[model samples]
Target chain A: MPMNAQKSVLGTLGSRAWITTVWAVTIFFVINLLALIATVMTSSFGTRWLGTWLPAGWTVNWYASAWEEFQLGDLLTTTFEVVFAVVFLAGLIGIPAAYALARREFTGKRIVMLLFLLPLLVPPVTYGIPLATVLYKTGLGGTMSGVILANLVPALPFVILVMVPFVEQIDPRVEDAARVFGANTFRLFVHVLLPLLLPGALAALLLVLVRTIAMFELTFLTAGPDSQTLVVALYYAVFAAGVRAIQSIDAMAVVYMLTTLVWLLVALRFVNPTQMVTRAKRP
Target chain B: MSDTARNHHLPLKMRLSAAGFDGVTLLVLPAILLLVGFFVYPFFYGLWLSFHPKDGSVFGNYKTFFSDPFLYETISKTLWLSIPVTILNMATAVPIALRVRLMKNQRLLTTILVLPITLGTVLVAEGMLNYLGPQGWFNRTLITFGLISAPLKLVHNYTGVFLSLVITGFPFTFLLVLSYLTGIDPTLEKAAATLGAGPISRFRHILLPLLVPGLAVTFCLGFVQAFSVFPSAVLLGAPSGPTRVITIAAYEAAFEQYDYSLASAIAMIMGVVLLAIIGAVLAARSLFYRGPAGGGKG
Candidate 1:
C-alpha cells in the first residue's frame, strides 16, 4: 500500500490499457485499408484461400470489360453534367442570396434558410413519392432536368452554408467604400467581393460536386435509364448483377473511389475544410 | 457646373433601378419558390392525403393508419430502433471525432469516411450485403476463429440492418461532431488540467458543458436521420420482424400498391414525429449555447 508500490501497479495497468486501445484502433483502420486493397487486388487476382483471404490470379480483363460493356463513358459524362449543373447553378444562385442574407438585414431569413434545407431534413422516403408525382405530372420525371432539380435539395443548402462564412469574412466597408465612390453594388460584387471569395466558391463547388455525384436515393427515384450515375450503376452491378451481368464491381469501385478521392484532394487545394465549417463564428 | 449637368443628364429611372428593389425576392427566389412548391406544398398535400384516401371516392387514410393495429406497429417499431441507433451512433461517433480531431491530416481520414456518404444507401446496402450476408467475411471469420461452429445467420435480420446503419451513418455524425469539436479552443482543457484536475474531472467539468450544444445538435441530426432511413430497411432490416421501418412500408403503399393517399398519411406521421423531436433538441441547444451570437453554427 506504499505510494510507490501503488503507483507502479497503476502505471503497469495504465500502459497495458493504453496499448490495447491503440492496437484496437489501429486494427480498426487497418481493416478499412485492407478492404480497399483487397478490392483492387481481387479484380485480377481471382479467388484464393477460402475465397475469404484474397484473390488467386491476376488479370486486367475486368477493367477492359467494364469500360467496353458498361458504357462507362456515357455514364460518367451524364453524371458529370448533372453534378456540375447542380453545383454551378446552385452556387450561381445561392452565393449572392447567401451574401444578401449575411450582409443586409432581411425579413424571415431563418425561415427562408430553413426552407432551403427542408429537403435535407425531411424524410426522403415521404417527399420522394410526392415529388415523383409532381415530376410525372409535369413530364419531368426520369429526365436530366428532373435529376438536376432533385439533386438541388442537397447542393443549394451546401452552397448557401458555405457562402455565409465567406460573406461574413469579407468586410462590408469595402463594398460601402465602392458605393461612396459612386461604384454601384453590381460593380462592388464583381470587382471587390467576387475575386476574394473564389476559394470558398471553389470549395463549395467541390463539395456540391461530391454530393451531386454520390446522390443516390433521389436519383434512383428520379433518374431515367439515361441519368443513372456511377453510384447507381455500381449498386446494380454488385448486388443485382455480378460479373456475368456486368462483370466484377472491383474495377468500378476502384474507379468510383478514386474519382471521389481525387476530387476531395483537389477541393482541399482551394478551401480548408476546417476553416469552411468554422469560419462563421471566428469573425 | 459639369457635375450638375451630368446629374441632370442622367435618367432618374436608371438611377432608381440601381437601388435594387428586392435581393431576397430576386436572388433566393428560385430555391425559395422550389421549397414552397415542392416542400411546403407536399406537407399540406400529405396532411390532406392523410385525412382523405386517393380512391375515386375520397376516404380517410389517416383514420385507417391510426386505427389499424397491423399498420400502427411500424410507428412503435421505428421509435424503438431509431432511439437506440441514435444513441449508438453518437456513442461510436463522438469518440471517433475526438480521436480523429487530435490527429493531423484529419481531412484525409474524413474524406475516407465521407466516401461512403457519396456511395448512398444503395451502395451502402450492397456493401452491407457483401460484408454481412450469409457467406460474408464477418461470419466466415467467426467460423475461422472458432467463435462459432458454422457461419451464423447475420443477414436478413436486425443485426445486419443495425450494423449497416451504423457504418453508413457514422461518417455523417462524425463530420458534424468533428466540426463542432474543432471550434472549441483546446486551451480550456489545458487550463483545467493545470488546476490539478484529473482527466475525468476535466472532461466532466470543463469539456462536457462546452460540448453540450454541439452534442445536442448532432444528437438530433442523428435521431431524425436514423429514424427516417429507407434503403437499409428494404435491403437488410428484418423483413417481417421488428425492423421494418415506417418509410419502407410507406414506399410500398405509395409505389407498389399505388396507394398515394396512404403513403402520404404515413409520410405525414413520420414528418410530424421528426419535427417534434428536432424542435425539442433545438430547444435544448438554444438553452445551453446561448452566447452573444448563440454561436449556434447551424
Candidate 2:
C-alpha cells in the first residue's frame, strides 16, 4: 500500500517499471563495456586502472609479439580460405535450389525447406566427430579440403535460410515472361533470376561468411594439427600455452574479438540484417 | 471440365514441376547429400552406437555415459548451463528487441547490439577470461576497492562460461526477435487503443498472440544454439567442476580418447534430443497456424 501510495506525478506504475528497466539495461551495457575496456587496457598496458580510472600508459607489446612471432598469419590465411570456399560453394548450390522453390510448384514444397534446415538442426557433435574421423583416416583430416568440407554443413544451411526469401521476393512473372519468350531454365536463372536474387545471394554470402568466420566449435573439434584454426590456436594459447606466460590471454582476446567485430560490422552493413533478406516484406 | 478432370491437369503440372525440381536438386545435391551422409547418417549411427557397442555391447557405452556419475554429470551440467544462459539471453534480447523494433532508431541501436554476433565464441570466451579471469581487470578493480584481499578466480569457471554464453547468445536472439517484431502490423495496436484497449491489453491481445510463434521459435533456436555451444565450454568452462558441458565429454571421447563408438553415441543422443524438441515445436507451430494467419511459407 505504501509503495503504491508512492506513485508519483505520472499515476502509472508501468512507466516507473519501464524507466527502471531501461536504466537497468543501461547499467548492464556500461558494466559490460567497462569490463571489455578493462580487458583491452590491461592487455595493452600490462597494468590495472585502479588509481586513475584509466591506465597511465599503453604498449603494443602484445600486438607486436602476436603479429611477429605467432603463426596468426598462417591461421588467418587458413580461416579466410575455408570461409571463402564455403561461401562460394553454398551460393552456387543455394541459388538453384532457392530459384526452384520460388519459381515452381511442387508436390512437397514445404518439405524442401525442412530438408534445407536439416543440416542446421542436427547437432554439430554428431557430424563433426565422424567427419573428423573420416578425414583423419583418409589423410584429409588436417587438410584444407577436410576443413572446407566440415564447414559446409553449417554454412550451406545458412545460405539456404537467407536465400529462400530472396528467391521468394523476385517477381514471379519475370521468370514466367522469360519462359514464354523461349528462355530455358538455365538462361532464365543466369540472366533474369540471377540478377534479382544476386542481392539476396550476396546477403546470404555475407551472412554465411560472418557465421563461418566466427564459428569455433566445429572448427575446433574437427581441425587437424596442420589445419588448426585461429580460434583453436587461441584455445591452446589459453589452456595448453602455459597460462603463466605468453603475455596474458587478455592481449590475445583483444586481437581475436576486435578482428571479428570489424568483419561483422562490414557484413551487417551490407545486409539489411533485420529483414534477413533483401527486399523481403513481412510474410 | 469436371473436378476430376481439373485434378488430372494438376497432376500433369506436378509432374512437369519435377523437371524444375530436378535441376534444383542437382545443384543442391552435394549439400543435401552432405547433410544426409554427415548429419543424418551420423545421427542414426550415433544412436546405434549408443546401444550397440564397439568394446563389447551397445548398452556398454550408454551405460558408461549414464551409469558413471562423471559421465552423467556432463549431461546435467550441460542442461544447467544451457538453461540459465538461454534464459538470460532471451530475457535481455527479447524485450530490448521489442522496444527497438517499435522505435524509430532501430538501425543504430541494433548495430550496437549485434556487434557481438561477429565475435566468435572462442574470442568471446577468451575476452571474458581476460576481463574476468584471475589477474584480470575485475580482480584488479576489487583489489583497488579493497573489496578482496587477492585477485578473484573468474576464468575456467562456471561464472566465466555463463557470462561468455550470455554475451554471444543474446545478440542473436535480439536480432531475430527484433525482425519478428518488425513484421507485426503497427496499425492493429493503434486500432486497439482507438477501441479503448490500453497499451497492456493491446500487447496481450494483439501483440502477444502474434509474438507467441516467434517466441517459441526464437526460444528453441536460441536454446539449441546454446546447448550445442562448444568453444566457450572448452575454453572458459571449468573442465572438472563448475562448468564442464556434455559437448566436452563427447569431444574428449571422440578425439582425445579415440573412442568413435562412444563419441558417436553421445553425438547421437544430442542430435535426437535437439531434433525432437525442434520437431515438436515446429509441429506445435503448424497446428497452431490452422487459421488464415499461419506463417506465409517456409
Best-performing candidate as measured by TM-score: 2
**Which lDDT tens digits does candidate 1 get at residues A1-283?**
6998998788788867865675476357446534634444354335332345544555677776777676778888888888888887888878877777677555576788777666666656667767765676688888999888877766777788778767787888887788899988678778888798877787777877766676666777778789888877776676454444222565676666666657766776765554323323233
- The lDDT values for all models are 0.70, 0.70
Off by over 4 Å in 2: A1-10, A30-34, A45-57, A179-190, A241-255, A275-283, B1-25, B139-153, B275-298
CAPRI-style docking class of model 1 based on DockQ: acceptable
**TM per model?**
0.85, 0.86
Candidate 2 RMSD to the correct structure? 4.5
Question: Tens-digit lDDT track for model 2 on A226-280?
Answer: 7776767777777665643445455656666666666676777666655432223
- Worst 10-residue lDDT window for candidate 1 chain A reads A274-283
